[model samples]
Target chain A: MTYCVGMVLDRGIVLMSDTRTNSGVDNISVFRKMFHWAVPGERIISVMTAGNLATTQSVISRLEERSKTPEERSNSLLELPTMFQVAVETGKLLRETVQDTQSENGEQGKGRFTASMIVAGQIKGMEPRLFMIYPEGNFIEASFDTPFFQIGETKYGRPILIRGYDRNMSFEDAVKLLMVSFDSTLKANLSVGLPLDMMVIERDKYEPAHEQRIEATDEYFLSVSSGWSDALRTAFHSLPNFSFGQPGNG
Target chain B: MTYCVGMVLDRGIVLMSDTRTNSGVDNISVFRKMFHWAVPGERIISVMTAGNLATTQSVISRLEERSKTPEERSNSLLELPTMFQVAVETGKLLRETVQDTQSENGEQGKGRFTASMIVAGQIKGMEPRLFMIYPEGNFIEASFDTPFFQIGETKYGRPILIRGYDRNMSFEDAVKLLMVSFDSTLKANLSVGLPLDMMVIERDKYEPAHEQRIEATDEYFLSVSSGWSDALRTAFHSLPNFSFGQPGNG
Candidate 1:
């Protein structure tokens, strides 16, 4: 399992991904799930993947390798005219990757080799956009009513995003909200681990505004975790007492 | 779908369930998911159901009808020697109900009529106990590590319980925690709706301590919805600002 979230705010786009993969409770490993590509000052694109590591690796490898071979990379992610087109190209690539792998293995019921991605960024002059790519290689863009998209182990972390997200929010606020969302997922799921990959793209900057790998012992995250627990405990105590009704009131 | 939670605490047990059923977003209706029985001073038991409504109703109807029969009510829930036995009987009833329904339909797939339950209560001589009954007629009791069990749309509401729940928490505190959990679920899932049913069983007391139905407009719940949104916003802003490697010579 994995948890990755992206918010498209007025200030820019904020993306965060956890780095944990597990075959079972006893077999757990850390693997970075966030990937980025930027033609410095031209275009900056970021994607975070979840579901079937092998499938995601194949899709990403294809994308990266295309960057080196001009002929093989035509109509690829980097050359797309707009973010929407980029998503379309990436979705096509994902579909091709899955079909090729299954045919080579000849596995009858591999159950779709599930994989999805959160793709967000800007093209030279286009607006920053956010999209959630589905396992079927189709995608949906974030709109005014939904300015953020999440993939993988999403339910556990959805409440924070629903209540705290603001389209007009500053990039810093967006990152903070993402941390809280990721924190919830990390605590509830053992398959989602630490040392998160976080990146921020300032509007029209065409380059990453900030990027960092958050380790388990990072001071900010430690404070966020402990502080949230304390806040919740305090809030729990402050709620009004149950009336329980009078003996005759039932 | 529904959202029901049961907690076993040192003070006693807290059981809460939402009354919402939906076949899809378009076809939704209100249907209580909680049932209770009280042999006034002898025993008090509350069962909350989730999953197939037809199966749960059949299981509860059978249990209810048996309690009224003189000769056939021997291993009935009310006559059970301990709370654990009561749970086992409920699980067996649920499994039997599913089996009968499946055979009637002549289906060869996994029984779609299966249901899960959270049973919590007290018998005269024993302490309060809580059990989560699976569709397979098997059950497990709540322990210190996991003092509460939730059924139905559980994920959205899980974080509050994980962070605020304490085995020794006051009965009032536990109810509030349950409400928050329910609030989270209600906000995130349309399949789980209003008019929640809640019952409290006090330690060693064989009758329900408190029972009430919360309407959609209940003031407390309204406050919880808005107050929680405000709290999230405040928490988001309170997180430390990220300067992200500002060339500070550190």
Candidate 2:
């Protein structure tokens, strides 16, 4: 399992993903799940994947392969006109890769080769965009009403996002919001672990604005984790208690 | 789908459940999911159900039927000597009810007739206990390490419980913790909805210490919901910001 979130904000786009992967509890391993391509001042594309490791790797490899081939250069991330086009091409590649792998593995691999992804970035002139690509290669773009998209182990962290998200918030606040969301998921689920990969693409810059690999022992993350817990406890205690009715009155 | 949680604390137990029941998004209805049987100072047992509605209802019906029948008195909740026995009998009844339903419904019902339950309360002389009963007639008691059990649509609300729960907290605190959990779940899920049923069973007293039906317009719940969002936003703003590395330094 994995947890990746992509947010489209007024100022920019933010992408974050956990590094943990596992076939089973005993076979846990850390793998980077965020991939990015930036042609300075032209375009920037970030892809965060969840679900089957092999299928995602195959899709990424195919995309990289196509980018290097002269004939396929026109369809590559560097040559794509907009983030929407990049998302469409990525979705197609993802679907084909899954189909190929499932065919090779036969009937038993019907659902085993499936994977999903969050693709977010900006083109030189177009607005930054965020999309959640489904296992079947279909996708949905984030809108004002739903400014963020999350894949894999999403429920634990979603409530925080729903309550805290604001389109007009600063990039710093956006990152902080996602940090809390990710921190909540990390605490509630073992499948999602650190270190985390975060990328901020400031709108119109067409280049990565900020990027970091947040390790488990990162001082900032530790502060946020402990701080959030303490804050919650404080907030909980501050809430008005339920006044009991008379005994036997239910 | 449903969301129900039960916690065993030093002061007593707190149980909460949402009233929404749905066959699909278009077919939703309100149904009470929390049931209790108390012999005043003698004993008090609260049962919270989740999963297949029919199976849960059948299990509760069977338990109620046995309690009212003279011949079946020996196996009824009223006659159970310990909360542990009550949990075991409830588990057995749940399993039998599910099996009976599935057999009648045929092969299509194989996975449909499953349900889970949280059985909590105290007997005359035993310590107040909490158990999560599975569909297979097996159950596990909550320990200090795992002081609460939640069934159905549980993930969204779990992070708060992980952060806020304290075994020695006051009964009021316990209810507040659960209200936060339920509020989070309600915000994130369409399957779980308003008009929550809450019960507090204080230690030794056996009878319910407090009970309430929290409507959508309930002032306390409204305050908690809005206050939580405000607190979270304030906490987020107080966190340290992510210091960006040099451009291109990932």
Candidate achieving the largest DockQ: 2
Question: Please, what are the lDDT tens digits per residue for candidate 1 over residues A1-250?
Answer: 8989888888888899999888778888888899888878889999899988988987887777744676655435677788898788778878777777667767773656678998998988678889998877899999899888888899999988898887887776677778888888889888888989889988888888888888887887777787888766666555555545533224
Considering every candidate listed, which one attains the maximal TM-score?
2
Summarize candidate 1's per-residue lDDT along B119-180 as a digit string, tens digits: 98888877788999999899999988888999999899999899988878877677777878
Report the lDDT tens digits of candidate 2 across residue range A43-111. 889999999998898888877885466665543887877788888999999999888888888988777
TM-score per model over all chains: 0.92, 0.94
Residue B53 lDDT (model 2): 90
TM-score of 2: 0.94
lDDT of 2 by residue, B1-250 (tens): 8999999888888999999999999999999999999998799999999988988988888887844666655437988778888988999999898888888889887877799999999998889999999999899999989999999999999999999999898877787788899999998889999999999899899898888898898777788898898877776676777656633323
Question: What is each candidate's DockQ, to 2 decimals?
Answer: 0.46, 0.54
Per-residue lDDT of B60 in model 2? 88
The CAPRI classification for model 1 reads as: acceptable
